[model samples]
Target: MDEALWAFGRASGVVALVLFTASIVLGIITRSGRLLPGLPRFSVTLVHRNVSLVGSVFILLHVGSLLLDSYAKLNVTDIVVPFIGSYKPFWQGLGTVAVDLLIAIIVTSLLRQRLGVKVFRAVHWFSYAMWPIAMVHAIGNGTDGTSSWFLLLAAVCTLAVGTALIWRLSSRFVESARLRQESV
Candidate 1:
């Protein structure tokens, strides 16, 4: 059961990172008017937003519980500080960075109206940095990281995230061109 829990936690981490990355990528290129062609007309962004939130919650819970499990031998500093874990410092630091980035992103999101668009967008760009940190954390620390099943799962996530990013960029390009055409 503990192994299963750990594995599940790792899975949630992968999913969360992927969704966050994909959503940011999508947001950047939404105006491109390419693949996810319906992105503008639908609730794609909303779904991405909500999903990332839920995934983050699950990941936090998982990491918190692991620290409490005794079997894991995690220190409080392990969670609060980056790269201070007994098992692996470099890989574990990635988790800490991700946590910090997530907090910043969420805090800024909550204050988006007050901060305004420019500041919010600048802070929000942290999502790109956070995702790869998370991916490295999961791939390096995950108990099942080397397993075929987990590898396949990670690969699929990478593909999905990549596709969404491409779609967003293209859509943004298309939208920009259309606007220019109309202006001319």
Candidate 2:
């Protein structure tokens, strides 16, 4: 049962990371106002939202399973508060902080209309912080953090997201340049 729980937690964590990476890339694409082939602009947003929701579910599973597993030694407080865990407190705390940021992002998104776009957008920017924090948590705390396969997977995820981020920023820069030329 312990082995089963451990495996479930690890698998769920990996799945959550992949889903989060996809959502991040999709989010950049959505913000850039780019249409995926055969898909409308809104569809990209919908896909991003769905991916994020699924990722959140996986994160829940990861945390719940680990909590159940005696090996992890994760208490409720450790999961909620940062840097208080008996095991690798710093790494575990990163996960806690990431989860906190995710909660804030989710709550603000749900209340977007009521809170206004400015509030929602402000909170959403936390995602940029959340992703790296989560990644670091996985690398520092995961059982397979030192394994070659896990490193490969992490590298791939980083590359994909990094490429997408560069594209997003470059596009913004180009647009600003174009706007300046027009104004002048």
Candidate 3:
């Protein structure tokens, strides 16, 4: 039973990380106002939203399995509050922080109509912070952290996100410069 729980936790965590990576990339694309080759603009937004929701579910499974596994030593408090877990406190705390930020993002999204776009976007920006925190937590605290495969996975995820972020920023800068030149 313990082994099963441990396996479940690890697998779920990996899946969650992959899903979140997809969400981040898709979100950057959506924000850039460029339609994917076969996907409409709205389709890209929908895909991003669905990927994020699925990633949250995987995150819940990962945490729940860890809580059940004696090896993880996680309690309810450890999930909600940061830096107080008996096992890998700092790394676990980073995961906790990521979860907290995720909660805020989810809540704001659900209430977007009532809360207003500004509030939703402000909270959504937490994704930038949340993704890296979660990645560090996975690599630092995971049992297979030092394994070659895991490291490769982490590197791939990093490269994908880094590329997307660079594209987003550079495009935005170019657009700004173009607007300034036109105005001049």
Candidate 4:
């Protein structure tokens, strides 16, 4: 029973990370062409936005379950603060980092208008950081890290997130050059 619950927790964590990656991809796709420069990026942005919201919800559930699980050995404070989890402070600290990143993402998203375009866009980039942090937490601290199913899940999660992030970053240079040439 305990193992099953742990597996579920890990699965939810992976699900949340996958959703976050989708959101990042769609966001880059949907942004303004002149400002963002992309191939058919808008619709995906909406999908990304919606999916990210759902991902956040799932992540909340994942954290909640971890705290609830007797085997996890995580206190409520451990979930919030970094390097404080007694079970495995170094690796679990990834969760702390992720939580902070999530809070920043949420705040900026909510106050996007107030934050303005430059600040909002800048902070938005950090969402990319959050995915890896969460992934590290799952892999390093999760009990199922060595399990075959968990390994597969981690691979998919990492691939999806890494691809989206790489595309987003790489396309920036290409887009900039394209815009520059067009202007010339």
What tens digits encode model 2's per-residue C-alpha lDDT throughout 50-85? 999999999999999999999999989998999999
Off by over 4 Å in 4: 1-5, 32-42, 171-184
Steric overlap count per candidate: 10, 0, 0, 6
Please, what is the TM-score per model? 0.77, 0.91, 0.92, 0.79
Instruction: Give residue 2's lDDT in candidate 1 (0 to 100).
Output: 67
**76-121 in candidate 3: lDDT tens per residue?**
9999999999988999999999999999999999999898777877
Off by over 4 Å in 1: 1-8, 25-42, 166-184
- Which wins on lDDT, candidate 1 or candidate 2? 2
* Superposed Cα RMSD, model 4: 4.7
For candidate 3, report its TM-score.
Answer: 0.92
Ten contiguous residues with the weakest lDDT in model 1:
29-38
RMSD of each: 4.3, 3.9, 4.0, 4.7
Q: After TM-score superposition, what is the CA distance of residue 25 in candidate 3 from its true location, in Å? A: 0.7
Give the Cα error of residue 158 in candidate 4, in Å. 2.9
Could you tell me how far off, in angstroms, the CA of residue 14 lies in candidate 4 after the best superposition? Answer: 2.1
